[model samples]
Target: MKSTGFTLETLKAKVQALTRPERFVHILRVAELAQAIAEANGLDAQRAYLAALLHDAARDLPEEELLRLAPPENDVERSHPLAVHGRAARRLAEAWGVTDAEVLDAIEGHVYGVTPDNRIGMAVYVADVSEPGRGVNAEIRELALAGRLEEAYRQAIVSKVTYLKGKGVPVHPRTLLAYDAVLA
Candidate 1:
């Protein structure tokens, strides 16, 4: 478990610089939610906070920068460059010396989903989708906070696909794979 030199104050400044005021607020909420979920589940609360803080670090970057940092790996990402922000955030976090694989995986997997075995990743993913103020996933948030992390993750991924399909958006391959992996 490698830790980076991100003091709470410094991390706030760093993340604030990486995204808009509103987006950073969302990050804060997710970080808080993730930390709570981690504490409930006996995971590393600080690690969960760190991963959530950096999860959307590149979400507000210009599309060109996003493409440069994380080239589209599939048609879904190619069609919606915003879809690659998670991977781009991973690249940025790596550049910033975040060496923990679990943290990196959480950041990268926050946008779509993560493998079920990555407990921290699943927590971050669930938090990202269910953080308070989203007003759309209170049930999922409750599930995560109650230590039903796997169930929360399953519902989150399934809801993502459901929402995307309802909007007629193409499901990201990785999201589909995660959904299947959770079900299987």
Candidate 2:
């Protein structure tokens, strides 16, 4: 459980520099949500906050650049540019001197079609979906927040799968398996 030296100021600065004002606000919301989840789940609140803050550090990049840096194989289609942000975030975390293996791993798997095995990963995964103010239907988000975390995770995965399918995008085996591993 290595920890990064990312203080509140440093984390805020890093996000503000990388994300637009609106996006930074989203990050703030996610951070607060992560901290809340961490506290409720008896995990490290600060670490969870950092991981959520940096989760989208590079989410605004062009799809071409994202594909060039970390190409997802057939098992993981490159249909979503948002997926590439995880790779960019990894690079940003390293450059920012983030040494926490848990934090780095969480950020890396945040959108890499992988299920988180650690507490930190699980926390960020939930926080990413349950962040306040997302444009997702209010009822769905409320249902996700109103029950046990495992139940919420299951719903989130189903929501993600349904959304991707509706978009006519290829669903990655890892994503499906990851969700199943937690939900089932």
Candidate 3:
């Protein structure tokens, strides 16, 4: 479990303490899915699992605390403060001794959107949305497992946007940018 002075068990304990039981289960599922996607795509499965495990580390924090940890970067993030968990997660991961830049970047971008250049980040992002517990799209999970990462990620984002629109919620700009980047 020890890797570069960080223990997987230690990180899991920290995550369990930070999240509720349900959220902790969700985190584990995301990690599992991320690992599968990473392995299928020839990426680092361990890094992907670590990133997914820590991606929601700060999600249940108080709104004030999340804002304090990482100030919102845009109007959407400011209005929906929970979205900033991704950004705040980077700090938590770093404090937990997760020094890999790829892992941190994946955790930081999992909630909002990852840059196209970060394959690990993309895997984490896709896995978070398509995790089985979400009970939404099954095709995204299939695409990810099949190694069609970009396609899976695009479908996940599109499904999210569509759902938001149906709910009369404004889509976050970062998501739109992510969708565009994937297609470009």
Pairs in steric clash, model 3: none
lDDT of 2 at 145: 46
Candidate numbers, best TM-score first, in rank order: 1, 3, 2
The model with the greater lDDT, 2 or 3, is 3
Model 2: per-residue Cα lDDT over 1-184, one tens digit each: 3645556688679779878888888888878877777776678888888888888888876677666655766545455556667767877787777888888878877673346356666667777876767766444335434534555555667788889889987776667777677666
Worst 10 residues of 3 by lDDT: 1-10
Clash tally for model 3: 0
RMSD for all candidates, in order, please: 1.1, 2.8, 1.9
Worst 10 contiguous positions by lDDT, candidate 2:
138-147
Q: In candidate 1, which residue pairs clash?
A: none
Give one digit per residue, the lDDT tens place, for model 3 in 48-160.
99999999999999999999999988888888898889889899888778788878888988876777778899899999988999996678989989989988888887787
Candidate 3 structure, TM-score to reference: 0.93
Whole-model Cα lDDT of every candidate shown, in order: 0.91, 0.71, 0.87
Residue 149, model 2: lDDT of 50
